[model samples]
Target: MGVGGRFGARESCGTARGVLQRVLDADRGVFETVARRHWPGADALLPRLSRAADHGVLWFAVAGAIAASRTPRARRAALRGVGSLALASATINTVGKRSVRRARPLLDVVPLVRRLEKQPHTTSFPSGHSASAAAFATGVALESPGWGAAVAPLAGAVALSRVYTGVHYPMDVLVGAALGVGAAFTARALVPTRDQARPPARPRAEAPALPHGAGLIMVVNSASGSSERALALRAALPLAKIVECEPQALEDELERAASLARVLGVCGGDGTVNAAARIALRHDLPLAVLPGGTLNHFAYDLGVEDVRGLARALERGDAVRVDVGMFSTEQRRGIFLNTCSLGVYPELVRERERWAGRIGGWPAGLLSAVRVLRADRHPLEARFQGRTHPLWLLFAGNGTYHRMGVMSGRRTDLADGQLDVRVVHGGRWPAVRLLSAALAGPLTRSPAHAAVQVPHLHMEHVSPGTLLAYDGEVTHVRGAVTLRKLPRALTVYRPMP
Candidate 1:
């Protein structure tokens, strides 16, 4: 090489080293400045706050409180927050810490009062606590703006505490928080938020514009634990007749209300809504659903979230026609607004109901799942498309259910006039087969399960008294049952954009 070429190469190398040294000097300078600063109340608060966030105890407690509100949206927000936190924490420990093996800052400049009683022993390039805080806050905000706003202050304080307690540099907290936000977005990308894919407001229908719910009669299933929502509806619509009834009296009261009212309204879970939908269909009355139940699948898909949402729809006279699903036998017929399933799921539902009253709902569901999966039960024998097969589960939704990341089975269109039929083929291990089917995507065929979209599904020669579950309710059917869609059969109230 010539002398000039060698000198030019040396100069470039020297310039790169100078820039790197300057960056390091600036980083250390900022750390020292923060360490020496005195904030009035931080000495007493920041250290304890940092300790509370250890092992995510604070976040988990917050999640439990949010879920205890018993609203579907709140629960979802809580779940998403935890999911994002998990992703961020995993990435920080696995990749962020390992990739950058930077040393912790010297504590000589930091105030003794502000320092944590026990210092962090890990590398200090990126802050794990800051990442968790940012991820959780961002995730909650994506799902629910109000909850996110409520949580943001705490998340910020936690992040600030990392720096105030001499545990993380400002850049560490900043980069960690950025990575945390990215993790939340990544989780949302995997499982899109409800606002990301709202159901289409199509096939508009005509319903009376009941100002203050003048001619509306609503039935509240008291047994379904919707008294609070019923009261809210009453306060919102003073003229509306709100009848609260027990489980046994729900049907009778709904029938009476439908006969007397210009509009039929119902509050409770999916089961109560299902009953109301049937009466509304028979009387040809437009239905206004107030979601007062856990997992209000049908009402959520219809875009009716709470009492206020339904109230706005009623006042605005905004309504849409949606398809209803029907499963009929020679002797009996029933309709489902969400989904209908035959097999282990129905058995699981029955088992859950039996134990739900004794041990509470969540625990009972877990027990039921374990019992049903462990029980010595044979698969259901049925004929599908001229072929007889042993099936562990046959699920048919009123509309096509789409997968959102790890979370599957959410519908974007409720009036597509098609039934989503998913079958988990019989296998030796029911739990393994069910898990595989759940993880599989829509329309993807695996050894354990297969999914298809069809206008209708016909099953022949089923055994007498085969259990069937539809929209959280269980029943029995036998001998040549057919599942079909009633296109745009039900008119429901929803706030339109």
Candidate 2:
């Protein structure tokens, strides 16, 4: 570049800075005048409020209270809220304050008795308290609307407190609030809640009534919580044949039930229900679900919440057609009713299982994530659609998912005939990048992630014997793998109309 071009660029930057500085100075004058007009209650209340918000104590207390609730939704909201507050505080205090140096409002205009007891010494272009307040409120709102609404007024007061206490100008609080909101949104994209993305499924139609399980063969897991309801089921459908099997013999028992039954009934967790669905599809028989496991994700979606509901469905013969996911490789081939995942996830699952008994599900999973994520594991080298990339995780759902959050999405129509595929592209700090993308939102638009919906996919692992998981079950496979959807291949009974 010529000397003249360089000189012109420098001059333009100087001019822009000068204009911004002038605007800042004028805004400061107006806010200073506003601060000087101390109202009756303002003198006593604003200072104390400002002190409460110092170092984000007020926001932390509120978030802690919400987090302490036994309700899952309240707890999820707390996690998001705290995460947002942490992000906003880091940005405003470390980055925003240091980037631009600005002086706080002069205390001379305020009454001596009304002076802020504890004043901040850092640059005040952006107010950290205000930023924290906005971020926490916005994050809570994103997770739970009612809780967010309740906290909004307090958040607003905290933001305004900075100005009222004469520690920051109006514009500082305004800009800080925007930065806080942005931080909350960024936090949300990276650490989304699955419950929010997936809501309860509404039943399509009532099942046709059947004669007390006349042609049904119900496979019950004697070890499952659903087993407690076995007698109830038998009382409800005396003619139905019930086969109680242990966990070790579940597969064989299901296979046996498949050959003899007209409608195969499953009473277990998602894993058991999933196994039954695959068998029912193979034998071309309708499947009835009796919710007897923790979470009961599949049975809940099937619209049969309990044994009674399942019995009602069987009496009515109410059913729905749903898609299944197929996985085929040289060493192994199977079908999944929910999802298939490849990469770090299988390892995480294994780690969780090892500790799930000791720590419980969610806590064990969290510890497992911390353990798996801290390790310097190499990304899985895989080929997809004629392109090779290092991937942290590759997930494919059976059909178009309705609720797309951190967890695999939920499908409204089980027969959508499309697979929801999401891949996290590997890069520096692969785990951190993956976590950020997961929290932030859709990975397709993100450089660290890619997503698509297709009828089928063929994936090839560069190395042999890589671990893969389907419906919470993991296995090792070599070389090329294929996944396709079997549209309307399974008939499932639902109780609701």
Relative to the true structure, how large is the alpha-carbon lDDT of every model? 0.91, 0.80
For all predicted structures, in order, the TM-scores are 0.90, 0.59
Model 1: number of backbone collisions: 0
Clash tally, candidates in order: 0, 18
Residue 492 accuracy (lDDT) in model 1: 94
Give candidate 1 misplaced runs (Cα > 4 Å).
1-10, 373-378, 426-435, 446-448
> Which residue pairs in candidate 1 have backbone atoms (N, alpha carbon, C) closer than 3 angstroms, thus clashing?
none
lDDT of 1 by residue, 46-83 (tens): 88999999988899999889889877789989999999
Model 2 ranges with Cα > 4 A deviation: 1-208, 404-408, 442-444
Q: Which candidate tops lDDT?
A: 1
What C-alpha root-mean-square deviation, in Å, does candidate 1 show against the real structure?
2.7
Q: Report the lDDT tens digits of candidate 2 across residue range 157-276.
A: 888778877788888999999999999998877776543343233324333456988888889987775666778889999989998989899999999988988888888877888889
Q: Locate the minimum summed-lDDT window of 10 residues in model 2.
A: 196-205
